[model samples]
Target: MQVNSEWEVPKYELTEFKPKAHKYCVCIPVINEGEKIQKELKRLSHFASVIDILILDGGSMDGSLNHEFLFSKGVRAILIKKDIGKLSAQLRMGFAYALSEGYEGIITVDGNNKDSVESIPLFIEQLDKGMDFVQGSRYVPGGKEVNTPLIRKIAIKLIHAPYLSIIAGFKYTDTTNGFRAHSRKFLMDSRLKPFRNVFSTYELLAYISAKAPRLGYKVVEIPVAREYPKGKIPTKISPLRGNLLLIKILFGLLFGKYNPRSE
Candidate 1:
């Protein structure tokens, strides 16, 4: 793939996934996930031969990035300063690095370890077949969720998924899932403008989920397992604040608030 010279790729520390050629990079966006990240990195080690791993850390003070296990697992870390914002900022940083590095595509998985590492290959498989966006769906036929919080589950199924599907004009089982793959071409597309300031929050993923289909990209969802440990909070989403933000994003998409050309 030809690299785009226009994007001013910011400098960051780099570590190799291993001494080998890799066509795709798996980007795991994280905050202060200490032991959870360690465990997830170990789980992802199983695919070291097939794909490279990139850990995008949003100023983890827990020293999770410094853990010896991450190095042993051959996962690369891009530590973003806290001033950049949260999940969305880290993702933008990771995606920019991946594009500049010339990866064919990038597969994103949350660092919380809620998602199955086994589905990584499935994402790459679809990417290889030229899918622009490969979304992981726990509600699909072969997918399942374990120990999910009742309220969160209800919101995802009844509100988030349905609203996104309607806006995108496509039937979708999971729209809020972070376990998805995006072709380098799609990320580098100027019209999408994923690195814009508006994406500094949680809206980036949702916006891209809806924007991809609207822009005529091949978007598909594959079943993947999501398990919340017993007695553990399933997500970082606060019902009131997160839902309000989501509603704002949905309305913005409908009203052309985030359109690149409108800026």
Candidate 2:
């Protein structure tokens, strides 16, 4: 499907390995993830028949996204971003493309293999139960957290989750987790206006976290496991810079800076 320019998505190249096979899809935003993404995709392959899989790549210079490997693993498509922007931009491409192709709901997961892909069925069950927004939470009762960095753990539990919960009028124990599901009804709501160019980075995620509850969407958080490798944190973000960015996005939410513009 040709993306309408008015949708505000970045220019992208998409390759479909097969026709759409499910009512939902898992849109993974990735770039230069090397073996991590391949391993994740392999794990996700077990659920291929249950939901479609697509990659929203930020131009991987690394030779990780081989088409044949993806096809062998049951990935249905890949959307490579050809324009500037970061994770949010790739996600914009993912959401817009999935919706255009008639996916009833979209599930987003980080492509780095930190999340447990096995718990995907739980999210689908919630979506089936009329949840407009489903956030995966490692801090919740049935959730598991393993080998997390002390600083990142503190930041998520102490700062990010608390701040977002207050503004969202909902207690969110795992606000930073990207393993979430969104219904078509929630995404199509005009009041959110998520496709704007302003959401180039972390803005869209934070904005949606706050706006979903305020707009009366049926929101819920389910337990899921997240584990980091025992040796080093696999991230491009420096600790100080990443926290600063999070603080900035949080402030924007505090002031309603990302609200939909009036027509």
Candidate 3:
């Protein structure tokens, strides 16, 4: 359960914790989610079997982190002391904690309240069936997306997704979606080395999605609803900069610059 110091990026500590027992842990990466997180946690509370609800906070300054509801719901918060590529750094902390705790799998959903907490059972089912990486896709059959910005929607379907699909050698409907699950076996694989400092940003998810299939692990996409409440701007992405970083990460993986196999 010892974490290698070389892989550590920003130091973080978990607080306001209560332990429980279950097969899966839900990792919600957040930063100033505000009132939306309250609704998300309330919905997730109904999923009684999820042992841990780890809130990975990227230094929220809006007083959202101080909300009393989170502590009441038995949610453990890991506050990253520094901003080091917000989402990816938070995820690395969650993944490391989950591995150390010996959970069977970890499920990641956006903290902005866009993704459905109901689909969690579906993810756990796939993990039980031995699927290594389960990606949530709104573009898939039976999936739903509401109020998504036109440009972002188009970018996902036309450019981002298709590009990743091509590199993965498999058809993917939503490669950019952060709603996904990873079995412990997949996370602990030496070939995937997800804890490396190179994954301090958005590149880790993309790398794992493509690398899992390439490494001969079972990967599947499941339908999930992603609903953006009207007038709520997504905090995680900036159209121009996000797209540029994604393109750069894609090419990095393509050229084996970020590929674990090459390392």
Candidate 4:
């Protein structure tokens, strides 16, 4: 699809280069994120002029769905009324839209504004360097994990290790992180189902990293700097709940609950 340059801001022009190297579609799936969407949008809008951007909302009643920033050049907002309350399902819809729009790649990020939008270039960099999926690692060297509490950190390690090993036979320290970029061919070949409407994006990352690599798609982690606020949405997710969800995804992977073949 040819981008309309008139929609671009003064300092930015719609990047017209056909990414023959990669026709990746990017999705920033959002929920009730009113305060931070604009900032995130401005940063993303200015950054990925060459890629199609989709900001999908799952029935955000906070009126955040009406944000004008979503209409900026290289960005489009999708408001889904069937509120499923899960990050993965919302992302699945966004992926469908991106695919329908002829994008050959997809990237998913949290909409709560904790992610550093500047790191998007780094993701593209990794993708361009021949990665099927470039996952953001907060614990990797040179990557800073700001405001993550000690307790949550421990829980993250415990929950991720065994579940990832049992299901995908892989060991990644930071499996629950949401920041991910995917190649279209990988997504098509892996044939994993949309993440159930019950879990967050964490399990989705686990399934992909474990399953994709086994299928011959190059999966690698890139260091990304993350900054969380002093008392925001608590990057410290509940250990018990998170572990239970991880277990579910593990079972799904093992028993074939997610039928990538159906895709």
lDDT of 2 by residue, 75-160 (tens): 99999999988988998899999999988889999999999999999989998999999999999999999998898889999999
Question: What is residue 43's positional error in candidate 3, in angstroms?
Answer: 1.0
The Cα local distance difference test for each model comes to 0.81, 0.92, 0.82, 0.63
Best by lDDT: 2
How well does candidate 2 match the true structure in TM-score terms? 0.97
Q: Could you say which candidate leads in TM-score?
A: 2
Better of 1 and 4 by TM-score: 1
Per-residue lDDT tens digits for candidate 4, residues 1-263, read: 53223221111112222232236656776767777766777677775566666666765667764545456544644536364445665665566555545666677777777787678778777778878777787877767789876656775667665566455554565666778898767765535444344334444556676777666678787787677778745433575676676667777767765545453
TM-score of 4: 0.78
Better of 1 and 3 by TM-score: 3
- Ranking of models by lDDT: 2, 3, 1, 4
| lDDT (Cα, tens digit) per residue for candidate 1, span 68-142 | 667688775554544556778778778877776778999999999889988998998999999999999999899
Which lDDT tens digits does candidate 3 get at residues 14-55? 674566477788999888888888788888878855557888
Each model's total of backbone clashes: 0, 0, 0, 3
Quote each prediction's TM-score.
Answer: 0.91, 0.97, 0.93, 0.78
